[model samples]
Target: MPKLTKYQRRITWSTGIGFILERMDAMFMSLALASIIITLHISKAQGGLLPAITAIGSIFGGIGFGALADRYGRVKTLCWTIIIYAIGTAGMGLTNSFWMLCLFRIIIGVGNSGEYGIAITMLSEAFSKKYLGRLSAAAGVCGQVGSIVASLLSAFILPRFGWHVLFFIGIIPVVLAWFIRFHLPESKEFTENRDAIEKDPNRDFSHWTELFATPAECFLTIRIMIMFMIHIAGYNGLISWLPSIAQERMNISVAGSSLWMIATIIGMSLGIMCFGIVQDHLGSRLAYGIWLLAAAASVFLLIIAQNKLEFLIGGGIVGFCSDGMYSGYGTIVSKLYPTEIRATANNTIMSIAKSVGSFSTVLIGFLMDHFSLMAVILFLSGIYLVSFVIMLSIKELKHENKAPVTTTENAEKVAQ
Candidate 1:
């Protein structure tokens, strides 16, 4: 591979860090769930609602920030999102009531989802199609690094100082916001479009309607949303419960759960890198087909394991298969949409899917209370097959030029 230019390198690192922070928030919430339940004296079902609430906030943030990014600028929107995430995360440390916790989680959700969409959209615009898959996957690998860090902190802090300190640690990502503000420039593609719209009064750039302007477009958007919903459901169903399952089933300590988490994160990083390479060489269809099936089979390992060694290795395989395909969502959305609505398309579909998926945490928690761990694992595994089938039907977008093809051409290509 050729070396990246200074700007490419900057965008890569900045977006990678953005993903890191996002993943860190998720991992912290998962790892800290047990402690939060005890501290707040909440039931498992209610505890599950916290992340769901955050997902609800993301729905608003994703749509709102996406429109703002298309209207204003990706970098400017991204900086504010990060600051919002930092503030929301910090506020969690001070809250003792469940409602207050819910409020803060919403803030974190909004910022987290916004940051995710803008960062991916910016990175997609910054690079060519040649490097899109791999660079996006690289940022995903960075997200795993964040998960690893959160796991370590969970092991060290949750047992020592408590979960409040964990929320305080979230405030640290604000430093990343500072660096992004000073160093990054706006995406050239976005800037060009903005200038064109400014120059031509006749050009109508209002984009939200274009998403559903026609039957075909609306159907395609729904198809993408369902696939992503399945993706999010499968992921959250397995990961959100893993730590708790290890503790309950295997009698693992908080620190030991961290070890399991680290092992899983290592697998996730390797899998994401490998998926990017595979998707680049092979088409997205074949690549997703393989990983989705692997995810279906691997999730069973979590339920059947009898020992720590089995669980540890099984967790890694599960992580590899399950989350390896996560970053591809961004790449796919960015490819399918034009510059004007790319951010909106990316955030709207993903956040809505996440909203649906996030609630699965609540459902899974309720299921675990009533059903067996095996039941939940079966649900997670079955959804992957559903996603795999969906992947086969949906066409991959392939654009050869920096300027994407016209909507007519895009539709024709998609049909082919």
Candidate 2:
């Protein structure tokens, strides 16, 4: 991999920090949920709706702002997204009513949704293809770090300052908005593409239609969407219930569960780092195949564990294999689509898949109610297996060196 230019480093940090803020806000909301429910006198169902509202906001924000990024400029749109989410988060602190808080959550979700797709698009334009994977993964690792920080911050602040303070802390990232606006440059590839489009009177680019303009593009998008669905399903299904499972089945204490989370999260971080290296050097297919298979196998470790130590180790392996490949999806779509619709492709596909995948928690609960814990684990393992097969069947493309958006011929060139 080549050394990064100063601007590349800035983009990387901004992207990474953006992810960190996203994760931190998510964690704070999760940790403060119990307090928010009691203070607002809302039922469990209404409290649950808060996150759901956020998810709905994310779906809309991902598509809407993504199109805006393609039309406007990446850095300019990114700054707006940051400000939107920051203001929404801080608004959550001031709201006294349940409906008001719900509205703010929607705003927060919408703002958070654009960061990943836009940042990934920007990075794709800024960095060398050779270094893209690791850099993306590094940013993801930063997100995991953000979760850890939020957890620690919640532990300290929730006791002293109350849940509202958590939302207030989110406003701190607004300062990052200023730094990004002034320091970061627009992607040269996107700028050039915009110029070319402007110069040609006959040219038409619709972010949504560009994704499915041809049969090949449609199929490619569908296949990628399925892969994303599987990825999110496997993650949400398993991790959502892992702690409860460990507590119920293994008789682990709350402290033990926390340790298990730390272990698993560390494993996830290390796995993401390794994925970056492996995918960058060895190619995405081999890296994904290996991780998916490992994920499928590792879940069984949870089924067989006899002690807390074994369960913790199993959780770590599961985290490593199942969640580590998260960043690679951005790298994949970035290569397949042209710059004009790249953010849309990334956000639209992911938000739709994520919206679908969010049901996995419910599905897992249904499965657990009807069947054994082992059965639920088996189901998750099967999701990984299906993902592996889908991954293998997709035609691989050679890495493009210069073009922001790949031409069909370049996009279709099979990897040797």
Residue-wise C-alpha lDDT for candidate 1, range 23-83, written one tens digit per residue: 8888899988888999889999998898788997899888888888899888888888887
Name the TM-score of candidate 1.
0.95
Every candidate's lDDT: 0.83, 0.77
**Candidate 2 local Cα displacement, residue 296, angstroms:** 1.9
Please list the residue runs of candidate 2 whose C-alpha ends up more than 4 Å from where it truly belongs after superposition.
30-52, 94-102, 158-162, 181-183, 243-259, 365-372, 397-416
Q: Model 2: per-residue lDDT, tens digit, 297-359?
A: 988998888888888888888889988998898988887677778888888888777667756
Clashing pairs in 2: 338-405
- Candidate 2 Cα deviation (angstroms), residue 327: 0.6
**lDDT (Cα) of model 1:** 0.83
Please tell me which predicted candidate would have the highest TM-score against the true structure: 1
Provide TM-scores for the models. Answer: 0.95, 0.86
